[model samples]
Target chain A: MKTFPIIRVVTKILIPYILLFGCYVQFHGDYGPGGGFQAGVIFASGLILYGLVFGLDAVRTVAPPRVIEKLMSLGVLIFAGTGVLTMLLGGNFLDYDYLEHHVLPGILPTGQHLGLFLVELGVGVTVTAVMTMIFYAFAGRVQAKHVQAKQEPTP
Target chain B: MTAIDVAILLFLAITAVTIARIRDLWAAVMFTGIYSFLSASWMLLLDAPDVSFTEAAVGAGISTVLMLSTLALTGTTEKASGAKFRPIPFMVVVLTGCMLIYGTLDMPQIGDPSDPIHIHPSPSFVERTQGDMHGLPNVVTAVLGSYRGYDTLGETTVVFTAGIAVLLILRRGKEEDSKTGGRPGSAAASGDNA
Candidate 1:
């Protein structure tokens, strides 16, 4: 893989834009065709491409497995916490109406806009973590099997 | 159906048959990816851009990579079955396909304005989301995020649970590896134990 300078160079140039598009899809979802799920998959695809090109060890350094495990749970917590917060604020479960605070009055209304953003963000985070984690698990198994094959060559 | 629709469907059918007939697992996976891309194009033609976006990214992209990785662990060539032709299973498949096609005869025509789907809560959701979601232009987002937030929460939880299940099945702790004298069992056997 290190011998493929062309692939390495092209991948380096393309990754940043891929990540940027993922963010665009994530935040602009309210006005566009993409939302959290699509955006998360796009983002994870970029990382997966990097892993495919540059070894798994490189990707593990870029996105540590421990942090990904924690983030996987954290995204769910963020989503449920938003619902609980709405409840605590004297509303029904996941009712975004209570989130209206009149902050930045002339701009977008605070309630549904803010709630949707936070909820979608939660979805994006969890999806990205889970997709990356699954890739790691599969690739790790292949690596482990290769190591075994090297240590004890079968007849 | 439109010419473009027919063309895509024709390609999709060809790809499916190729995947089934192919002996090489690697080629089958690649054809499956092609099939997903064609389906995504068909979804876009049906005027559901959001669904198309997801289908392209997940089905065409991530699924292909994951299948390739799985093929790396398993052998690249599918083993030949002991019995080449099983008439009972073939008959069952043909019967099921005919039954499914028969079931579609009762459904409404595609994009019929008088259909129940267009007449019911869909219209109300579209009308209300403008006011309720503060003039949000994308009704799909508003509906998923606010109107049916609980369902989305459940979906997210489902994804989380699936990840946890995969981790439990695939992950081998460093302590377990050392304890087992660095000779871990096959993934399936260990997964069963876990």
Candidate 2:
């Protein structure tokens, strides 16, 4: 079932483009319409498409469950850590103005720019991980159920 | 309203009715995706491009896929037992719909610049984004990331907690293995095996 030629060919052609677009949306969110939420979903959709075409095991191989588990928390940590860093830098929580105190006075805006990028990246990572984790759990449970049904015949 | 707006609205109404009437859960999921796509177009017409983009991606794409995956785990055929109309539930639904419609009557006209919501922080957010907020072109990002940073932080935490909850409930690996593998010929496992 995973080896269907048409699906395999089309998915192979489309996956990289979809992932690239997801990254574009993630970064361009500051100037454009989409943001972390949308980009994360699009990114997860690319992986989900891969899962749908190549089966659950293939996706697990690409993104193991343990790695997904860590990513889910890592993103949150990054977001909160940014805030804590701001606080430690003698500013209010999440205050990006204090991010680059050592930089030249003329480039103060760099702090805000970098801060926004990191915050958005954190949001994107967490959302992508959660969505993929949920899909994996559901799909894996179903697949395991099917596998069990096949392996052990019912009386 | 423009012709395009009217046409899109009419299609939305048709899709809603079809979704209600469709007996097959799978078809209903597809129709729901269509409904999201139509509403996204309407949002674009209403000049909410960001919202439209989100509606298209989350509502139409990811949600449709999730619903399909759910259908794979559940029954595709919706039960037909609801044919007999229950007057009490019907009245409840009608009353809720009427209340919702009445609630919208108090809303300011769409795109009214002077609306209460547009008066305070929004004007400042727009004005100051170019100056105090590091001259960011996207006022929405500036507002969300800086002005309302606390709110966004809380929202991220909420999402994190939801992920944890789903993992806890759905990823019960050991329990599931014990349930299925421990009793292969048991009635519950056997019923599911078929």
Candidate 3:
């Protein structure tokens, strides 16, 4: 495999920290300042940084373009599906009060508290996957351009 | 004005000047990305973390990349009409900025509890939000996901739509190699090299 020398080592070190920060952002959304969207994008951005350093081909090896595309759609579906569920449950669209089907030992909590968590998860999934898909798409395009330029005639 | 407010105004000025002055279309676009990142930071300082998060994720990251891709797909950079002064547009922008600044003079300070925003049903929602809603302790989240659920859903749809539109336009066309300048008709010529 071709190496980027300095960039590769630097990104490798930074990747783990970015991953940790992203998780903190995700879980900490409820307490201070953060949410699914920020966490997801930051997480995807760290992976994208790795892809950039090692070259696009390596990224495709782990998360191929077709798979990334499918995951993006899946995220949207998960988010929309939750909303549709709320609609069917006799509440307004995205009314998470209906999502209070979580199981606990004794009591069942609803709406603002427990339901919001699931909904945020849906949002987080969609935002993150879609972001990664976008980065992959562009890298694929760049590679395609490189190959095409090579194929051109000199005459 | 507070230090953060001053910083935000400085960003707005930078964004405006960057938009106005940059000749290279690519550089201008990058400035817009900078503008977006700054705006997200400003919003965070304004106590609107949810909006800040959305703006940072969508504006600073995905949107900028998509814009750069569009520049790649199209060849219309053409250097922007030889950098004309364009007084009419400049005056309009300055006038709009002045109007905005003038209007802000009468507004409440950031985080002021009596600022009409926090004092309304918002406070009621903030106060009794957890008890009735049950498990969610975060009032900001509670408002976004439950009370203003439709708005949040709409925002998600908007994000999805933007992504889909970019994907559609950038998708590999039926002609295959045409997008990257390797149309199928040229395949025969390349094969002749073998």
Candidate 4:
């Protein structure tokens, strides 16, 4: 990947747009044909493409394994936590209608939109972390094997 | 179906057959990606843009890359089997496919307003989302995110679980490496088992 200037340059140019599109898919999902699942996968693909082009170490540096592991769990927590919050606010589990406030009538009808946003964000976060982590695991295995083979040449 | 739908479906069938017949794993993976893209197009033609988007991204983009990486770890060419033509599995597959086609005989036509799905709370969700969610525009998002929120939570949990399961199977801890005498092949061995 480092040797091919054309491939490297094209990948570098494409990555930012991919990330931006992922953001657009995440945020614009409410009004468009995308949601957290698609957005997360898209974002992960962008990072994976970067990893494929620049190498596993580069991607791992960009998204550390420890942080990704935490994020993998944190997304589920964020989603479940929202439900718990709604329950505490005198609503049924995941009942976003109760999320509405008389104070901020201008925001949107009920708390449904905000609740959706948070839940989707959680989904997006978890998905991105998990997908990227999977890529790292697989690619890391190949890298490890490559190093091992180099170290020990079979006669 | 329209001409475009027919064309896409034709391409999808050809790609699917190509993938099944191709002995080269890399070409098969590429063909599988093409099949997914065609399926996405067909989904779009059926007016399910959200499903199409998901199919295109996860099916075509991510799965292809994942399969390619898996190929990197494993053999790229499938080994030739010594067995002769097996009729039992072929008959079973044909029988199952026939049964599935027979089952679809009773299904409602595409976009039929009188379909069972179009009735029974579908209209209610679509109607209420406008007022309840304040004209969110994308009713599918509203349904998934709000109306059927619990299901989405469950799905997120499912994704989380899958990731954890994969990590457990593949990820090698430093302690495990030392315990296994720094055998790099152990991870690949476990992955193959998985």
Q: Highest TM-score, which number?
A: 1
Worst 10 residues of 1 chain A by lDDT: A102-111
Weakest 10 consecutive residues of candidate 2 chain A by summed lDDT: A101-110
Model 3: colliding residue pairs: A113-B135, A113-B136
True contacts kept of each: 0.79, 0.55, 0.40, 0.71
Ranking according to TM-score, highest score first = 1, 4, 2, 3
Model 4 ranges off by over 4 Å: A102-110, B86-89, B175-194
Q: Per-residue lDDT for B21-126 in model 2, tens only? A: 9899999999999999999999999887778877887789778988887888888998887588789999999999999999999999988989998996556757
lDDT of 1 at A78: 87
Worst 10 residues of 4 chain A by lDDT: A101-110
For model 2, the superposed segments whose C-alpha errors exceed 4 Å read A101-109, B85-106, B174-194
Q: Name the DockQ score for candidate 1.
A: 0.54
Q: Go through the candidates in order and give each one's C-alpha lDDT.
A: 0.88, 0.82, 0.70, 0.86
Which 10 residues in a row give candidate 1 chain B its minimum summed lDDT? B179-188
What digit string (tens of lDDT, one per residue) describes model 1 on residues B153-175? Answer: 99999999999999899987884
- CA lDDT, candidate 2, residue B31: 98
TM-score of chain A of each: 0.94, 0.91, 0.78, 0.93
Question: Scoring model 2 with DockQ, what do you get?
Answer: 0.44
lDDT of 1 by residue, A1-155 (tens): 87999999999999999999999999999888888888988999999999999877667767877788998999899899999999999999899988889667867648888888889989999999999999988988888888788989765
Candidate 1 displacement at residue A51 in angstroms: 0.4
